[model samples]
Target: MGVGDVSKRILLGRKLRSSQLGETLLPKRIALPVFASDALSSVAYAPDEVFIMLGLAGASTYIWSWKIGLAVAVVMLTVVASYRQNVHAYPSGGGDYEVATVNLGQTAGVTVASALLVDYVLTVAVSVSSGVQNAAAAVPWISHHEVVVAVVLVLALAATNLRGVRESGAFFAVPTYCFMAGVLGMALVGALRASDGHLPDVESANFQIIPAPGYDGGNLTGLALIFLLARAFSSGCAALTGVEAISNGVPAFRKPKSRNAATTLLLLGTIAVTMLMSIIVLAHHMQIKYVDDVSRLRDEQGNPMPSGYDQPTVMAQISKAVFDNFTPGFYFVLAATGIILILAANTAFNGFPVLGSILARDGFMPRALGSRGDRLAYSNGILVLAFFACILIVAFDAQTTRLIQLYIVGVFVSFNLSQLGMIRHWTRHLKAETDPAARRRMHRSRMINTFGLGMTLTVFIIILLTKFLAGAWISILAMCAFYALMRGIRRHYDKVNLELAADEEDRFMPTKVHAVVLVSKLHKPTLRALAYAKATRPNVLEAVYVSADDATTKALVQEWDDRNLGVPLKVLYSPYREIVRPIVEYAIQIRKASPRGVVAVYIPEYVVGRWWEQLLHNQTALRLKGKLLFTPGVMVTSVPYQLESSQIARDRARRDSERVKAGDLRRGTVRSGGRVPPGKQVHR
Candidate 1:
């Protein structure tokens, strides 16, 4: 095996045969973390955002945190219910884009696709950014290097995901499960501690959160407080960003895709809500005073402690406060939370590529995205997602707080469109189905979708009203840009399709085929080309050679007579010693001389097995073929003559093909076609 093969085997594990893909199908336990990590990891930052927003009106407003949590939970449950219908209806895994495109019009579908695309990008940025911040809590060096750390983490996540969905999921499953267990365990411990009156106060409990300059007293009521609550609710809705991934990735599940996805969505929603509410309750009981600005949070002496002070993430603080001085608890919570946040990006990694593949298959994106990678993955889409996510990370400097404002906008956009689309989907389906039982089920599903639509529309309005001035517009703009680009791509493909259609006019034959053999010297290649041209029986046949030097041309003419060649030889002389330009001029002159005749240039090419041999030959032939291609009425044909070295390469390929044990083509198989020939130079 080559070094490349050896390295791949070590990294990707043993290759699985195409027939064994079913064996890699995820069971519910593994599937839970593989697809659910995004929603589950929201626990790491969602509570902090809730507390931060509420703290804007001072610590007393923290009383409203549970209410905001309830609102988010309602949205979460409604979305989950709605997506269960989505998976059942659109099991191809196009998610919102498919639903809107099929049920609504193309515009609506594009809108949903754009929203989902933006959301996927933000998912990576927010998840990795949050993970880095959490890690910075444990490692102070990472605090100052937040953006860099976050970017590296994003790249690492992208690489892991590039390995293929099942493999990536399996690698991250342990950390995801650990995070779920750790948070639930910590929440339970804190609840028990609160019940026993032995719960320790959070480290920040003593620090008072001074309200923003405009709100000094507790006198504010009516609309102002309502607006504040709405904004807080909007920010807290970041927890809902990954709710649709399971729906989007239904095909990744085993048979009965909808059932498996629905079950997984249920598990995701339950765990996410439980963890979210638990942390909020724990924070309230322990009086954890979270503020937006670190400046306002000060020591008793009223001195600014440090410029880049490392504040642990909200979940980290809760874990430390609840599991105070317990080393294992602290590290467990820290490790799991950080790891889960990083793995949360995996949801986007899986969903974006699958969706991209669907879009590409539909001709809405580049066709390359539809092609599977070595691991039978949509490698192009994965790389595209990673690139955009990396851009956002760099642009936002990896600040989770800033990125959070932009987080839920795209998700809510997709949620509203998908729910609305599902309503239409059921209405249309109901019109065709005659069974009463099926009708009744459709009606129930419609009710669920209708409720979801209402909830998501409300959340969408809240997000726009609250977050439009705060970075959310960026996501909106991004979605619009993606929509326009996808439409343009569709139009380009449509135009090409029209242009390439075979017509009666095209069916008419070419006026004539004027064949010419490009000869360097009277060798096997030149002789072979002349023979092939004669077989074509064109209207005209001639040997065309560029004379860079007179002696070579004279020797070639003399050899032609010595061999009694069949066709007439025509030589084009070049004063500047250029091979391509003179021949190009000669072909153009031939077309102008006899417009009814077509020019067919047959060039002889040498093929070698060793990489070095190619450089020694074919430079002139390649240039001659390229020049002939541009002239009107001309078609260039290459007749390749295999050298001894080429036989070696052919032999190597045969050996490699025979040695294919299992999944050699399915795993870690990068293309090796564009190799340079040994001992020769070639044009680019």
Candidate 2:
């Protein structure tokens, strides 16, 4: 293997065979972390959002925190159940994008695609940002360099994921499960201690939150109270950001993929709901004080909390309070929570690639995204997601609250559209089903999806109203941009496809063939180009040279005559010392003169071994080929004359091609045409 290839193998680990893709299929245990980390890790800060929003109404409104959690949980459960139907119905891994497209038409599909794609990018950004923020609680240095640390963490996650799904899942599983155990364990311990009357207060419990210009008094009533609660509920809905990932990733599950995926989805929802509600309940029980700004905390003496006050995250406060009796438990909770937050980006890494592949297959995305990498991972998609996530992290300074404003919009948009699509899906299925049970099941699913649609739509509207000006407008604009771009790509593909449709008119050959060789000097490459052009037996064959210097042009003409080369020479002069445009104009003139003829422009090119040798050669020929390609009735071909240095390259190419995988073995090998003479090179 070449150095680059070896380096790649070292970085990505061993290259898996296409057949081993089945080995990469995740079982429920591993798949849980691989797909559900984003939703699960929201326990780290999602409740803080609820607390922050309620803190705006002062501690009096904090009573609504658990209520907001329950509402978010309800929405999450409904969305999960709705997606269960999606997995069983459209288990090919198109997820919401596929469901919308197949049920509602191309525009709706692309709309959902745009939303989900945006959501995936935000998933990485928000998760990594939140993770880094959570880490800052333990690593105080991270607070000063949060953005840089967050970006580095994102790159690390990208590298881990590029190693392949199964491998990355292994790396993330322990941290994810540890996080689950830590948080749920904290809740259990906290609850048990409370029952035993030994539960301690949170570190921030004594620090009072200053209300943000509203609701300083008790018993606030009417529209003001309703909007504050709605805003809190909408903010809390951040918990639902990654719920749809399981539907998007159904294909990565083990055998009986849909059923396994559904079970995983249920598990994800139950765990997320359990953790989210548990954390909120613990925060309330322990009187955990959280705010967007630490400076908002005032002591009982009516003074701001001391300048040295180390305001930790909600998770930290709760961990400290619940695990105060055991130092190791506190440390474990903090470490696991931080690691899980960092690993939560794995959800986007997994979903974005799969969704990108599905989009590529449908011609709504770049074809390159559809290709699996050396490890059977969609590497391009992962890189793209990481790149955008880093941009958001850097742009927003890696503050979770800033990034969170742009968070739930995309997922909610996808949720609303997906449920709407599922509603149509079942309605369509019910029309075709004759079996009583199947029809009944379809109706039941339709009812569930319809209910989900209503809930998500209400939440989506509330999100737009509450968060549009906060930062969601960026996500909204990004979604529209993506939708338009996909449509533009599809249009281009459709136009090219229609234009390339086989027809009898296209079958007819040119009435006359004219071949022109682009020559710079009377070298072996030029001679080869001339000879190759003559071999085609065109109706008209000539040597075309661009005269940047009179001396060189005369010398070339003299050599052509002395060698008795049969083809006549045509020279085009360039007073400006240009080579490409004059030849391009000549070819265009030839084409215009004989519109019924095909002008074959053969250019002599170099085949060099070393990378820098390419810079030293092929400049004129490359320019001429680029110019000639756009001219109608003209075809540009390169006749490469391999230099001595190219032997290494040629041998390397041959040997590298020989390293095909086991599946590449032909069942019935057949030999074709005999090898050509080494003197000639084919223009493929």
Best by lDDT: 2
> What are the runs in model 1 whose C-alpha is more than 4 Å off?
13-18, 213-219, 432-436, 505-508, 521-524, 548-563, 575-577, 588-597, 609-633, 643-648, 654-684
Off by over 4 Å in 2: 214-219, 651-684
Global lDDT of each candidate = 0.84, 0.87
Worst 10 residues of 1 by lDDT: 668-677
> For residues 1-684, what per-residue lDDT tens digits would candidate 2 score against the true structure?
699988987789877879889999999999999999998998788898999998986777888899999999999999899989999999999988888889888888899999999988888888888877777778878877988898899998899899999999988999999999999899899989999999998877877877776566666689888888988999899998778898888889998999999999999999999999999998998887888877878876769877767678888888888888798999999999888888988999999999999889888899999999989999999999999899988899888899888888988888888888989888887888999999989999999999999999999999998899998899999999999999988888889899999998987888989899877788899889888888889999998888889898889889889998888989999999987888888888888888888899898888999999999998877777777778889988889898999998989987765554333323222113433334443344
Clashes of 1: 15
Q: Each model's TM-score, in the order given?
A: 0.90, 0.94
| CA RMSD, predictions in order | 6.0, 4.6
lDDT of 1 by residue, 19-49 (tens): 6667667777778898899999987798999
- What's the lDDT of the predicted structure labeled candidate 2? 0.87
